[model samples]
Target: MSKPRSLDKSTKEDVSFIDRQPDQLTNQSVGQAEPEVPTGSDCAIAQQSSTQNINALPVDVLPPRLQEIINEANICLGFPKDYLAGAMLTAMAAVIGNTHTAEIMPGWKEYAILFTALVGSPGTNKSHPLSFAMQPLIDFDAEQAAIFNEAMKRYEAAMELPPKDRAAKGYDTNPIEPKRVRFTMQDVTPEAVHRILSENRRGLVLVSDELAGWFKNFNRYNNGSESEFWMSVFNHKAAMSDRKSSQSGVFIRNPFLCVIGTIQPKVLTELAAGNRNANGFMERILYVFPSVQSKVRWNRERKSPSFDIAAAWREILSRLIGIVPAVDSCGEIIPEDVPFSPEALDRLFSWQNEVTDRCNAEGSDTLTSIASKLEIYAVRFSLLLALADRACGDEKKLIDADIVERAIRLTEYFRVTAAKVQGIVSEDALTELQLAVLSELPGTFTTAEGVAIAAKCGMSERSFKRFIKDRKGVLFVHSAHGNYTKL
Candidate 1:
């Protein structure tokens, strides 16, 4: 392959300035200063004082057999052993903090976007993980799960609920009925989303497969109020007005609900740039891109476990709901000595700065938007980590550098990979141009011939020459005859 092209003159100059004055470029840290750890006595006192009715269901009460099954199933689902521990810890934290509520409430987390995309080739069981593997963690009961499934079906059918006849006797008049509604895998409308949140108050986990398909629809309707509605729901704090009795002027807030979506990488690329969906909306999501290599294919020749692991997991998760921590709000439980190193913090901030600068320079507003989304994801992940630690009976609420490192790396991979797919950098185009020129001209060529070759490759002579020069080591003078030769 041809050598990679260097940055343009202006970009090179900017890079030089950065290299010469690294302190000037990244003088500040991205997040707040690490808090000091509390003493054991302090933690105990704090836990006793602020203890709420969060843990209605205690894990100690769970049967050992069930616990073992849960552990084994989690492993089967391909979750790393460490992450499984983290998940348990997260559940424990939620139980301790507000047993009734998950600490990472959608809007309360302060993420710019709440987006989650699962990417892999077709039939990689991508959607199954979100729907079956993770869904049960939310703890939907049989009846509630049935209702959720139906809601998805109705959503897919595009069958709007018939307008209620308020005057009819024996007809339920409740504005939001407790009906099991499943969203159509295809039709993800603003109205449908609004209804799902409004009716499913106990918290609903909306899962969709082939996200690229829905993303296309999102783009088609990404104008006017439709887009606004989508953004408002994601804001988490925003409440939707009652569609059915505006005269009553009632508004409802959805606190417990969350969305988990799965999609292929190609679909994500299309949705990220092709659609006019604001970067702000995209940034609010916790993107989990599943690896294709990790997919477990089932065939007739090979039999795998067909047990309802989701059902089992849901039971475990349901037990965690409404469990709040019994700790003081101000008291910090993390050990100060175990905090992330200054160097780790520095690296994180540097990465954030790099992402911000690149997004700004590329004029891709989504880059900055994703940065905000990533911050929320990081915080949520941290909170989960803290909760998991506390659940494991660890006294500290502070997460170590390893957790932060993993979160940052995950966010960066998604952002950088997405940006590349969208062709945000000129590197791809330049590389293609260079390859084309090399392929056509095997020997030295005059300026006129070079321009002709460039024209044939569908680029302007100016652009072609600039690429040649910017590429540096690849181009050389042939006897200074206003001709160039491949080095």
Candidate 2:
């Protein structure tokens, strides 16, 4: 018999995300100057440069304290600030989910846990920043594990006693199962994850250094049940774990799983071709693909991050982890509700209407669905930013317009990045012959030229036309007279 393969194993070379990516982002410095935002009828020019603005990190978009953390990771250590931002924010949101949840608008409550994907090639320092950011959660889990070990020891010792002696032991004879204090899990099955969430009703995070296995083996153990569970978690819907073989099946009233991970460009392309994701999986995720952040000037005198930074992250989390959950009649702990201010409510409506307008104008179901999910993410982000602005302390504050605007900026950044990711994946999906035609064609070409070029590649002009017709959105949407322009 053949040896079984490790389907979920990550790259053994320790390269973060991928082996390499050649399409480096524009090398812009942090202090690079930007043109002024026009306020009047000259806005058409502004629209054209919107992608550029979003691609560039508005360094000040973060609260001053959080920005300090970003600077240490990115500017000082040469990590991609975008990657650091997503990972750290998601971790912060996970801690918030343990007790506090934000209700952006009335009847629109959302957990702080967010599903963020840091998209970069190998050696982009994706995991370095994430490792630092997730330390608090790791420590929290360790503490809980130690506590559980001791509890189990006492329980085991009590069992060694005689029946009458065990009866006299009282509570020590029966140990309560350890609370699910582990907030982060790497590769795990659906049932295992369900069990974890059942214990830790607050939430748990799925962290993968290499996302190939997670995406590829999504439903390996349970048909489509695993995928369905993830979808439910993303929407904060009710979830249950029903297993035929196990009597310890768990049912959770609230299931929260925040996913943070990195993947190479090649893996992303493979999944894209599989088209295995539907019902807005790709749309639901926030992708961060900042270009080429490996260019750092090292000085022997430059100091690495010190204990203060670590202490700061720990201190913030220390307060957040102490969140006391409110319990219901059944003694189930309920998450506290975080809400937006009145002005924030007014602005949310305006933003929602604007997004709706844009989605309708796009005239594409895929794009529309992405916009719809982004709307929820925008609210989630506002909650995160609002928390960060207050130093992530226990004292909660209602999200305001300013916080929403900042989150919208980050959301817009993801929008631009997603388009780039899609562009690369779609172009990669093209056949060798199609890619050859594209390479041979000029930036702008006529239909006759396109057809002639297609014929050169062993394709009939009619077949070429049929193939290129639907590809307008993916490849090059034409102008008139078959005048196609490569984006």
Candidate 3:
């Protein structure tokens, strides 16, 4: 097939051609020539050009203070440099004043993967960056500070309350005022989540630790009721209820709530098989897998060292709160000659395809439901790098393939782990595994007998049930008797 047409360089910067058909363009050398500098006779044009470049900088080359924040956050989370950098830039750009009209501000409502998973082994300081490095952004002003305080109080109250009380109340005994809270699986409840989303319209970062624990308990507590609750919170429409008034009313819309969850790969298998909530939830998250295999030891002494720059960076980010990027009305496509390479494009598409395939195979429609979410995250990450580039003083609002590649790589690591947990056996192995188990059973067996047969086949009762359901009308047959038979 011919190569896709090069993005139209002549089009204004505000256009987006990402969804258009790829037309074959004439093969030209990569990297278009920079536009000619305007002269004094074109004073108006020169002024505009000068303004665009005034604060522009390459995202890769950040200021010392910003770089310090990046390094600190990375260290706290033990995240790969690229992953932490991308997330920080995205968050920064969302808060910073955007110079490009084509870029969308980073917000929880626009992306499906509002929750991000930060996976790493212990000592990675998973909670440090969020609690400390980004503390400034999270605790920017009185409003934010108050919100944080309230959240802690509510969490404390929930912990102190009896489980019976919590279940009966349909709300936390300690109601966390939305602004002061940071949510995680530890404190995540349908009611708490609903309150947070409804009240915090601007957005907030939710950091969860040992996510496996949350998923493990999700089903046991309520007979899989909490699992459904999570599903609703993750994708449910946000609504406001004013029941106190004589004429109660409410409005429904998307609420801005971003989540960051951490988990280990070893825990994934158990979480996935036993907990219905954990099985497919990863697809709803933007996965940012930290490097668990790194041999480079962290500096123990620096673990708790206070960085002076952290305070300064917080102040800078605070000033940019509520500033959103202007959307491009011109419908300009990101130029093809920009830095993203063919290899990078392939990686992104592959990751998307892999996630899509796994979700399809499992018959889980939520996978398809959140495709726009993954795209939004990838685009937002690129925009963050673009904004950082501008902050470092680059004139171009363009995002190259490298940014896309990095985001995809991080997303891929997360997505693959999630897919594995779904226990979706490859088609090649499915028949063999099914036949092997069936062949061991008597020609005719009751549903309870089939369960016994599964035990003999070394399949857990849970896995056996799921396997039967997954292969219905395909490899195995299900009957009204609740027993499964081989075709």
lDDT accuracy of residue 198 in candidate 3: 51
State which candidate, 1 or 2, has the greater lDDT.
2
lDDT of 1 by residue, 211-280 (tens): 5554555544424444445556555455665444234333444333344455555455455553333445
On TM-score, the candidate that comes out on top is 2
Better of 2 and 3 by lDDT: 2
Number of the top candidate by lDDT? Answer: 2
Please, what's the RMSD in Å of model 3?
Answer: 17.6
Q: How far does residue 208 in candidate 3 sit from its true spot (Å)?
A: 2.6
lDDT ranking from best candidate downward: 2, 3, 1
Better candidate number, 1 or 3, judged by TM-score: 1
Summarize candidate 2's per-residue lDDT along 1-487 as a digit string, tens digits. 1111111112111111111111113323243333443333222211322333335444455665666666775544665677777777888788777476787646868777687777766666677778888888988888888987887777667777775677676745554544546788888876778777787767788888877767777656576566667778899888887787547767788777898888877677755533443556777778877654444444555568744677877776676666678878975667666677887777667767766765564344544666677778878888777766655432446776666656665666665565566657767777898788878877667889889888988878887887666454335534445466554
Evaluate model 3: give its TM-score: 0.48
Q: Please give the TM-score that candidate 1 achieves against the real structure.
A: 0.51
Segments of candidate 3 deviating more than 4 angstroms: 1-109, 141-189, 212-252, 270-280, 291-309, 312-316, 319-376, 387-487
Candidate 1 global lDDT: 0.41
Off by over 4 Å in 2: 1-54, 57-59, 104-106, 167-174, 293-299, 305-307, 392-396, 440-485
Q: What does the lDDT read for residue 61 in candidate 2?
A: 54
Candidate 3, poorest ten consecutive residues by summed lDDT: 20-29
